[model samples]
Target: MMLELLSPLPASLNLGLVLLSALTSGLSAAAGIGGGTLLIMAMAQVMPATALIPVHGMVQLGSNGGRAAMTWRHLDRGLLAAFLPGVVLGALVAAWLLVRLPAGVLELCIAAFVLYSCWGPGWPQRLLGRGGTLLAGALTTFLSSLVGATGPLVAAFVKQHFAERLPRVATFAACMTLQHLTKAFVFGVAGFVFRDWFGLMLAMVAAGVVGTWLGLRLLHRLSDQRFDTLFKWMLTLLALRLIWLGVKRLGGA
Candidate 1:
């Protein structure tokens, strides 16, 4: 019974999930973005719809939680303090309201956000003071519930606020950790059975830690300009794919 509860997943798929977790964490660690989205997309290719969202949320919580611990010394406490209250409010609304956006609408919004992050005129740093921070938090967390992977959305905000690589990466991880934690709470309240996937989730998290360590080491060697270029290109391609997905969803409907 305990074994069954730990993981109903087949041995092969469990191995794949662990590997995917590590690779995606490595992506986040090196790029300071996109890993969570990639992980969810990769897993979505194989996971059942009923189990996918909660299970993906659990893995990301672990992945970002590990990164947050790794970079705690550099975390922006003021930013977090400003941002977190909105997260709480956002999560509460998601739990109570159950905002089920139309699939086409969500896909379009995500694509638009991704494009804006890459090419649009960004909001000024001065304008997004404490209030801006709170609104950013509220919107990102709210969208996270609907969109599956919002790392890039929050990353765009963090990048706008922090120009340096280390501080930017640290804060990004911390915010995502908080976001994933809140998501986990919403899932629990909604009665998703987390216990069933504990074994696989734990394995994936452990793998993520190793990947994060490797990626961080690589990050130090890469140039800031190079990383930024890579980040934008990757985001653009992902956004295009999202737009395509949205079109497909709209067509299907």
Candidate 2:
């Protein structure tokens, strides 16, 4: 009932996972990409399918919350306003259908989209208008609810709109935090058994704090262009992996 198949591992293992999540989140945050994508993938290997979204959402909620707080001054209020309504609507829909949706299909679609976005010419730059940003938020939130982590898509959209490096990182972090919080609330409402995962969540949050601090420092030292290039390639690889996993799941199904 508690969703643990084997016994819970030692605290050390949990700590290591949390720290790894934190490091990944921090790097992803610093690079102006969302860390939730990596976090969810890593967690999915351990947590039950039913528990994945809520657990990942809570940890990411904390990770992004911290990053956003650290970069609050650079947030774009107008952009945030335009994005919120769509995100709220998307979150509602995603929560309702999460359990019923064919996850393999959903994940495959997401992976395809992400791959095209990365490889397709000028897609990110072309989708930088107010309308595009709002749509990006809605789509990203919807995909995130079902897939557990698709920060790269949102990051691509935000990166295009915000020319300044710091503003880009800050705004992306803020937007992702909002999306993750919405997801956590939706999962809670849908009865995702949060009470049993408190210890794991706490460990992740603590690691996130440390990782965020280090990432912020590293972000300041890196060149924006270099980070952007690296981020795009990283996203492409992640997308490929998702596609592969989706294919495997579909085969099994």
Candidate 3:
């Protein structure tokens, strides 16, 4: 029965991913970042190249949607409002250009930016404002459309504006939900057959919701100081991974 429900993928792998969904979702909920990036990295190891980005986006959509709904009250409305328009514009631009950036180069640039954001001075207040949010939404969405995991970049940018954990997590979830939604739509238009993978996606999402609930509980127990320190280090490690992947890719090229 379970095998039929998640066809094509081996039963063991399917079950493992469902569990990974829960685990990564919990990681994001408690830590304020890294879940989506980690999930994509894992999926890339097993999923088909053509289906990887779109499938990953759909799974993330479900995970972030659940997170956003759970903490809706804490979301920063003004920033979200400004950021959303950029998401739409970025999607349009990416679809129009149909450009595929060299994965290695893009990864390296993103890693650099993420490292700077994590350890360097905060962006000026003006840059974290409406105009900046709009630009960020567009750029991150564009990059996500190409690369599939911009969670670290988005999280690094979002962290600059909010100090508290709940608002940051909530707002970041909301932002990612839209970004992944747009990516799904773009890939759908480009003719990816989503239905074939729907069953697996649904199962993964269900697992993620359970994980999110547990993660939020953990989040509540964490001190602000601890959360900040953990969040930065988590991003730093993820960034380092990106740098490694980028270098490996470039070397191969």
Candidate 4:
């Protein structure tokens, strides 16, 4: 049954993705960021751009949903409430503007956004609270519909509101869960055939659940100060690779 379910993809690729989902979800669970960014980049290598964003959104919905559930006690309800309206607006706008874009252009866009989020200056303080979160929710979710990952930007913005690690991580996960949920709805309305990819997405999400559990445990054990440098450099490398892939695709075309 399992083999037949995964028949659309080579067994090796299916298994690899399952493991990658676990690792990335765990990374996000522990570090409060990076998992979605890494997972999408890895998927970009094997998946078509047309299918990439929607599939990625569903997988992340499961991953972030799991993290949010695990850390439910730490969620900041006010921030989440502030952010919800913007998510709805973003989803509406994304649905109206949805169009098929070339893979290379999409890849370059994702790479550019990832790079900017990594090194960009902090958002102005005026934009850090309820007002900022509303804007961030709209902008990030809009971009997420196009690109697949905006966790870094969302994380940075969310960070400004909390000092303690658990609250930060929990709230961020909750925010992402809302965003990805909307993304999934938008993609479905836009005519993406999610059923074709359901088996793989389910497997990946299950793995992400395990990773999220392990990651929450690790979060309690590790210090945020230690991951700062490594996190930045790793994202930079991944973004650079996406840039190369984008250029290569454009050149070939």
Candidate 5:
């Protein structure tokens, strides 16, 4: 019984995933935008799609939640206050819909979202506390449930609210932590049976903790300007790759 929970994948692949989780957590912790997307993409290479989304949600909940704790003092309290209710509403909607997106459509949407995050015009940000925050929360979470990682969507909103590196990184961490938690909870209530992947998730999360710590140390040393520039370009390239993948998948289909 104890071993059955972890047998769905070979031991080596499971361990590799655990290591990748740590590395990506560190990446996101330091970079504030790429970790979840990278983590999910890597897992998709070796895991069944059915097991990937919810398990990724659980791992990210741990990773971002850890970063949030470490950066607690830098969090934007007002943003969080407004965003929470919206995510709750979004989670409820997901629970009600429970729809699975076709692979091609999902790839296209994610690619579009990533591109927008990289080069989109700035938001007023002040409006975020108004209906904007609620809408952002609802739409992003809804899309996240379908697509596995909404880091770019969340990062786009977070960027509008912050210019400094630490504050942006910190607040994004909190918002993602909340979003992933909601996603995991929705999956649980929807009968995803997390127990099957629980052991692997725990191992990944434990590794993520170490990665987060190291990432924070690196983040503190980077200049705000340099961080922002790297973030924009890296995400842009990643988005382009996603678009290419989507096009190829569509062509093949």
Candidate 6:
């Protein structure tokens, strides 16, 4: 079933989409942003709405999984351990709600929540304790499943905790991979077919690997302050985009 849809796409188009998705994924990874948001938006226009979440999840699972594997040595095991259960629980709840809920409203809510988390006040900074990490994991994972990706939100939380650059990026990727993996499994059980899209998925994965390698190389050259500044502005812009999307949906509704 999934294969039939993929088989119709021209080889060139498949390759092109994969390369494009990969570049974005790499940039997102380098900046500690999740790539799923962009992938979902792009795929949403072309694929059935029902399939977009699962497909995006599978592709991101591959992309983030690769990034996590490459940077495994730098992962913060303590943080990962603390956050995993919350993320899993969030993903499960999100999966159950995916089909029944209004996705537009969900996305809007996610966008608003992320905006608050990123720029609301000094509260987030002050609240940056053990409890915050667990809450961030659960909330971000749940919202991520609903909206496709909220990398900037997760990145913001990570930056608040980890002062170092490399460990922060690696740790965020690991956490995101876990989230994406959970999303993929949930969507699979919900009846999103993957076998049919295997070829397309593979191409996207290959491109993502190359892009991640390039991004990692670039990461090594960036200064801590520079990365921090870049991340702040990028997240601000992402917040605005989400807000705009929400407004658009509201107007349409």
TM-score of every model?
A: 0.81, 0.81, 0.81, 0.93, 0.82, 0.77
TM for candidate 6 is 0.77
- Cα RMSD (Å) between model 1 and the true structure? 3.6
Instruction: Looking at model 5, report the run of 10 residues with the lowest lDDT sum.
Output: 98-107
lDDT, residue 236, model 4: 83
Candidate number with greatest lDDT:
4
1-253, model 6: which lDDT tens digit per residue? 4433553466655656687777867776666664555565455545554555666777777788888888889898988888887797888888787767653564466556555655665336854666777787788788877766666677777777678778888888888888887877677767767777777877787888888888787775644566556655655566566567666766775
RMSD vs true structure, all candidates: 3.6, 3.9, 3.6, 1.8, 3.5, 4.2
Residue-level lDDT tens digits of model 5 in 1-253 = 4433563988888878889999999988877778888787667557765677789999999999999999999999889888888888888888777555555555666667656656776456575665898788888887777677888778878888888878898889898888888877787766887888889999899999999999899886645567667766765676676677667777875
The segments of candidate 2 whose C-alpha lies over 4 angstroms from its true place after superposition are 1-13, 103-126, 223-253
**Ordering by lDDT:** 4, 3, 5, 1, 2, 6
lDDT at residue 159 of model 3 (Cα atoms): 85
Evaluate model 3: give its TM-score.
0.81
Q: Where does the lowest 10-residue lDDT sum fall in candidate 1? A: 1-10
| Clash pairs (backbone) in predicted model 4 | none
- lDDT (10s digit) by residue, model 2, range 58-79: 7888888888898899998888
**After TM-score superposition, what is the CA distance of residue 76 in candidate 3 from its true location, in Å?**
1.1
lDDT of 3 by residue, 1-253 (tens): 6755684678888888889999999989988887776687667557765577788889999999999999999999989999999999999987765445454665676567657656776445567878899998998898787667778778877888888889999999999999999977788777778988888899999999999999999997755667567766876787787788778888885
> Any idea what lDDT model 6 has?
0.70
Over 4 Å off, model 3: 4-7, 98-126, 223-253
Per model, state how many residue pairs clash. 0, 0, 0, 0, 0, 3
**Which ranges of candidate 4 are over 4 A from the true structure?**
1-4, 224-227
